[model samples]
Target: MTTAVLALQGAFAEHESRLKELGETVIELRDSDDCALAFDRLILPGGESTVQSKLLKERGMDTLLRRKIEEGMPTFGTCAGMILLAQHVDNGQGGDTQSGALATFPACVRRNAYGRQLGSFHTVDTFADMQVPMTFIRAPYLDSVEDSVSVLSRVDGNIVAARWKNQLVTAFHPEVDSDTSVHEYFLRM
Candidate 1:
């Protein structure tokens, strides 16, 4: 199946490489026209959420993407992508909230829940019942989730990954790691 990776920013290249390694046709979606391409699934790569959100709106892709996800498109989002899909977002400072971009995932996310760049680290965590390498870079975590959401992985008592219907999200970057299990799971979905 063809998978479209949002290429406006962040780790799209890494995700593209991993998907290619798994023998999947990859496409980089850089604009609204790219979003119109026929793809079986989507990967919203980690990046600056605010910037990505603004770009999506300015490029006329926000509505289309949200509609696709809402229409049951299988999607995987990491880090800032998680923030983009969340129904609610806490900026991680004094409980301030920010408007989400897609708002298709049924969870409340906290931006920069683990602090800043210096707070970034790597660790192996349990994901979908298997141990996998997890790399957190200025990540955000799910502060809360709806009952329909299934928790997939957690670190230090914080919810880092979850799945709701066709949507899967992680606060950590799986494409940056050597493991392909996460991408495989998305493929299965």
Candidate 2:
């Protein structure tokens, strides 16, 4: 099966490389035309959520990609990608809220919940019952999730990873790490 990585912004190349290393054909979805390509799965990489969301809408890919995801296209999101997929987003500025991009995942997220870039750190945590490395860079943790969402992994009691049906999300960047366990899990799904 092929995997498509949203390349409008962020660490798309890293995800592509990881997928290729796993012997998967990878495609980069940079515009609406690219989104029309046939792919089995999708990966939304870490980056600025606002910028990525704006670009996706501007390029006319927002609605199309959302439809694909909602139609049971297995998707994996990391960092800002998780924010894009969340149904609700709290900017953490006293009730400031931002509209979700795809909003396919049924969860609420707090943007920059870990503070700024300086707050970034790395740790090994349990994900899908496996000990894997987690890299959080200005990541957003899931403050709440619907009953349909399955909590996958947490750091310090905060929900950092979860899965809801065909959607999988993490407030950390798994592409930056060498471990392929997370990617393998997504591939299997």
Candidate 3:
């Protein structure tokens, strides 16, 4: 299956590499035209959510993406991508007014909930029953998840990962690591 990775900014290249390593066709989605391409899955990689959101809207791809996602496209969002997919973002740095979020996941997200860049960290966390080392760089954490959301993993008493329908999100960067366990699980989903 083909997976479209938003390459507007951030660690998109890393995600594409990981997906390719898994033997999956990868597409770099930059603008609205790229959205027309046939793809089975989508990956919103770790990056600056505000910047990514701005680019999507400016390029008129946000609307198209929301439509596709609502149509049941399987998506995997990491870090800032998680913030983009959230139904509500408690982005302490003022509300998301300029470039709004996709609001796909039925949850509230606090941008940089893990603190500043100096607050970045890494740890071996259990995800889907496997111990994987997660890297968190100025990541956001889920404050609340609705009943429709299934908690996938947690770290330090915070909800770091969850899934809702065909959408999955993580506060850590799995693509930056060598382990493909998480990516494999997403493919299986």
Clashing pairs in 1: none
State the lDDT of candidate 1 residue by residue for 137-168, as single tens digits: 99999999999999999999999999999999
How much is the lDDT of residue 34 in candidate 1? 91
Model 2 TM-score, 2 decimals? 0.98
Candidate 2 local lDDT, 52-100, one digit each (tens)? 9999999999999999999999999999999999989999989776658
Better of 2 and 3 by TM-score: 2
Instruction: Return the lDDT, model 3, position 103.
Output: 81
Model 3, 103-144: lDDT tens per residue? 888888888888899999999989978999899999998988
Cα error, residue 89 of model 1, in Å, equals 0.6
